[model samples]
Target chain A: MSKIKVVHYINQFFAGIGGEEKADTPAELHKGEVIGPGMAFQKGFGEEAEIIATIVCGDSYFNENIDKAKAEILEWVKDLAPDLFVAGPAFNAGRYGVACGTIATAVQEELGIKSMTGMYVENPGADMYKNKVYILETRDSAAGMRQAVKSMTAFALKYGKGEKIGASVEDGYMNQGIRVNFFEKERGSARAVKMLIAKLNDKPFTTEYPMPVFDKVDPMPAVKDMAHAKIAIVTSGGIVAKGNPDHIESSSASKFGEYDIEGLCDLDESTHETAHGGFDPVYANYDSDRVIPVDVLCDLEKEGVIGKLHTKFYSTVGNGTAVASSKKYGAEIAKLLKADGVDAVILTST
Target chain B: MVKEIERAGFPVAHICTVTPISMTVGANRIIPAIAIPHPLGNPALDKDEEKALRRKIVMNALNALQTDIDGQKVFEG
Candidate 1:
């Protein structure tokens, strides 16, 4: 098989440019070059594919001047006409992820070339474009670069070679919610009966749809008066007393901590610390109130902006914690705050 | 989780560094966090300055709860 030509897309940071400072760099194209993650992708392609060119753009630039950036990118991509357009494994950088997703989807939609991008499942870009093009599931941060590249490389090879693409579950991509027809040995009635029997016998049966329909909540009225409000504190930033006396696990905490700030006006390193293991904990360890703002609440109370601060605050680690666990914690915390006559809460998260 | 708290009927202002993520998840009342690890305050500044910054952020959160909203709203500090 001949080597399949490929074009790569990345942001300025991945192009070895400055971080946020260079986020406004304009779009540029480099021929016959492999940049940052493209090196890994090139290696993964391993004789099956060749990265003919690299497309680099600043995240802020692309997002800020979307129409211009996209038009320029589309023109360059059309000129190259590569077999595949492989965009970023964007991790959690919002603007970069959106740019990658946008360019990939547009390349495929307008130019009729196969395109793909990679990002964390929850990235807003993934939501906006997963249905428009193939988006490989990736970790929330750059720490997961290797795994993301490996999965994306495999998918690119298969798709570029005109091989049949499998279901998103089997292909390491986000489910686009597209209905697909597949051959089934049994009739619909027979399959339904089998499913019913499985349910009756307490056996596991996979449902056709895996995602739950989103539950929409009507926005409640805002607080009427700040001066009379009794405010409470809650966090998924994992701000807890030193040593984590509640023994809450760093991530996926099954329980939450309820610490008293009865008369204390400030939280210092000696008295409180973070149990969160997600990000750099240096700052949070130096000052727990940085995460929970106990000191600020006290100042607000003294200033009469708030009637009072709740004596107790609720906290839990949000790092990798399941939605169900968080929801449960919130319900319990709300109950307690309501019982204490608290009028509002300031919930912080990492 | 912030959504659940609101569902329980008490007003809640979610302070998070990534306001986009909060908006994507449908957190109704939102306040921008200063940083991810230290959402309420930044530790890089002088002690007194950090305290004031924290105070400003918390005040914004408090103000957010009082302001009525029809949908996702991000309160400024």
Candidate 2:
């Protein structure tokens, strides 16, 4: 009989405030007010729910003072105690999407409340917070507001009522690596045959499981001179200083290690070993250079095959580590190597 | 990891036992290693021979870095 109470969040632009020039506006809470896109959501919720409050913050203000803004917003959401907290269908606006993601995630995590937001697939916030929060996929711009509101409102109602949320595809949310099982009218063999025939006939057919899109990076130009190029070594082979000083994990590595090899010519059992649990450690333990090739690299340095060997080598275990984590470490390590003026890198993996 | 370093404007040579994974990860220059345990070393060989094998592989990786490539390409030792 009672409608679910919802608290909505939006940026200054959507709140009918000035655009970029007004992005420095601080947070404002309008109790019992349905503003901008919240009207569409209110209509979608109709009899099932009501927008009890709306929270608005400037995109730049929230991002520039993230902690302060988040703390202020969290206090308001706590006071409101709405059944569901929803942020923007920000679409392609990078800063707004990030703010919505940050605030929504904070409300859910810090306040123990159910929260959701919507954004385009390529929104930086989508990649940063999708796994942590429920982000509905919207078009690249606000032109898709109607559809976004319908889908987000439906999902919000289910979640606010404690109903089971369905698969990402079925619910119109970004795939967050959660798998839900459901039976279909046809069995595996029948579905396979149908898909095959559709493919053969060049008919459109959706795949049950879609492969993840990989980021393609343009190749950097080749090193012009091996004789003068400063080179470095990096590995996902789990190599580390003896005794595993940093205690890098044997598998599912949570961190990477950067060890100084400025004076070392080789990596032997006594000097270094592997922390990788995925492979036999005998060879690597006997001679860590077997995995990192530090000895040969040192030899190359002497032979003038390279101008110099970077003093530090970065290492992390790839065994069972998440691709996202690996990518994170890779980006960080690359920054450090670049700062060191390393011209090229040889990345070894086991 | 290779892709990240390459993306940062540095030529990168990825030497790994799994060439397909390197290709999938979009590494431009790839050199297949000997095995998963000791990617650069062949334990079956004598000490001198093993060191030579590693040297050869490292040389191949260096060569991969020096050569221009259009897309992903595996450089054989």
Candidate 3:
């Protein structure tokens, strides 16, 4: 049987060429040469796979000229046409991890071969390429090379042999945010009940799905004067003009609406309604001011409690909308409001 | 969205029934709304009474905007 050919990728430090001083070295391909870390990986692979070639590039050199380096590296990888491409267990080195992920993803995507890499979870490259390549989780530094190589070698052999790759947890790889399915011994309800019991008893319990982290924004200083300040209204409660003119999605809002409320004193059933599908639309439809507070804003303006009510108000349905889309809408709205000389905003939501 | 508005340098008073969600999303100024459907009015009360409730809530929101706060703050209606 022919040995599975492997192409290994490493930075200058791992290639025994130099450290920070040699970081500007250009890309080089060494035929049948096992560099520093490659020796450990080779021993791990044993007779199952052979390190056919090693690709080396400097950290600074590769990252500074990514486009040029990628093309050069891709050409070399294609020429070797190895069965498996193994990039660095880069640890926490930012540039090296990025280089590994970039090249490994390109080799798999461009060359139609299996590629794998390893790096620490917090490395910026992990977020950039984890979803594209098989990234084995490694320690923050090189002290964990023994364990990293063992896992990588095992995975490389399985992939090279055309065996199915298991879930990230079972295969000892970083979670790539891809959902995998397998039947559990206990039903989902039973598992939930068990987890609840453990939680109630002050015991540790792992959740099936981890919650995503949210950004904490520091609050800005409040507007100083209510009597002379220009105020604006914005809502995520799906308040829009009557007939739903923009056709904004009733649930996961695809767009926002800006209506002229210049001389309007109140929002009644005839003039406004809600496009939100998350809550009961009856009360809001009966009186749109219930959700937007446009009526009260106008009252405040007349009573001189506020200097002026901005002529236009922005509205959108926040239910089930993607975070990315919401972010886009917020940025655009802020730009518009800032340009309009709106000093403060009353943001209403359901 | 509230966070985005505040980030753009415009102070915002977020009125919502779900105060916890509002607080969690990093809204600087928070004012409690009546309920989910009718944030300003209470349909269960008399028309005049409901109007009074909404007016109070809106006044609170306006007051929240003018109050100088360093971090997340909940204003009472």
Candidate 4:
């Protein structure tokens, strides 16, 4: 019988503040105000729910000072105590998606409020925060604002009203790996047979379970003149310094290790071992070089096959690790390698 | 991880025993290794022979990195 109170969050551009030029603007909370996409959401909510306030922050400002920005926004959301908090359907704007995810997740986790945002499935923030919070998949840009607002507002009202959320595909949200049981008109065997028949007949049939889609990246041009290139080694075989200094997990590694191998020609049993539990560790432990090939790489460097061997090698366990986590680590390690002026990388996995 | 590095504009040569997984994960350049546990080593061989085997794999990986390609490729090791 009572209207649900809602708070909306947006980036400076969406708030009509400005674009990249005004991306340094700090957080601003407009209490009792509806701005930009909030208007669309307001219309979608109709009389069932009301947008109580809109919190806007510059994407750059939020990402650059993430802690301060999150703290500031958290205080505002807690003060308003809205039944639901909705951030942007940020789509493909990388930093905006991250900001939305951070604030939305904080509102839900730190304030015990229902919060959600929407973004493209491939956005870095989507991978980082999808499991931590609800993220509705949106088109790659704001051009989908109308459809995004419609779906987001519907989900917002349903969740705000304490209604049970449906499966991701049914509700149009990214899959968070939560399974809900429901009865269907046909049994699984019947569905399987139907699919088989359709496949044999070369007919179109939707699969009950879809394989994960991987983003294909065009190959970067090959490194020219290996004789003058700086090469680095990275491994998912979980090789680490003796005693596993960083304590990299034996499986489903949560973090990667960066170790300096300067002035070293090889990784030996006493100096290094593997943390990978996926395969037998005896061979790799007997000679850490077995997994990382540091010895051979050093030999190549000595022979002038490469101009230099980067001093640092990154290591992480891939066994059972989430694709999201791997992608996050890979991106970070790539940044570090680029900063070090490394020209190429050799990545080994088991 | 291979795709991430390549996506960032760095040429990456992925060395793994499973070429299909490498291709599935969008690795542009790949070199098959000796085995899963000892990707570069053949423990059954004498230490010197094993080192030679590893050298061959490493050489293949290096070559893969320097060979330009428009799409995914698996090179000989």
lDDT of 1 at A198: 97
Give me the TM-scores for chain A across all models, comma-separated: 0.68, 0.61, 0.61, 0.63
Worst window of 10 by summed lDDT in candidate 2 chain A: A318-327
Give the runs in model 1 whose Cα sits over 4 Å from its true position: A5-44, A50-129, A137-151, A162-172, A180-212
DockQ-wise, the better of 1 and 4 is 1
True contacts kept of each: 0.80, 0.80, 0.77, 0.86
Residue pairs with backbone overlap in model 1: A223-B65, A223-B66
- TM per candidate comes to 0.73, 0.53, 0.52, 0.55
B-chain TM-scores per prediction: 0.92, 0.95, 0.93, 0.95
Ranking by TM-score: 1, 4, 2, 3
Cα shift from native, residue A33, model 4 (Å): 1.0
Sequence-dependent TM-score of model 1: 0.73
lDDT for each residue of candidate 1 in A176-221, tens digit (9 for 90 to 100): 8888988978888888888899999999997765785686566667
Docking class of 2: acceptable
Error of 3 at A103 (Å): 0.7
- Candidate 1: docking tier: medium
DockQ, cand. 4: 0.32
Task: Please write out the lDDT profile of model 4 over residues B27-73, one tens digit for every residue.
Answer: 88999887667889888899999999999988898888888898989
- Candidate 3, residues B1-77, lDDT tens digits: the string is 88888888888899987565566557889998877667788778887788788889988987787788778889977
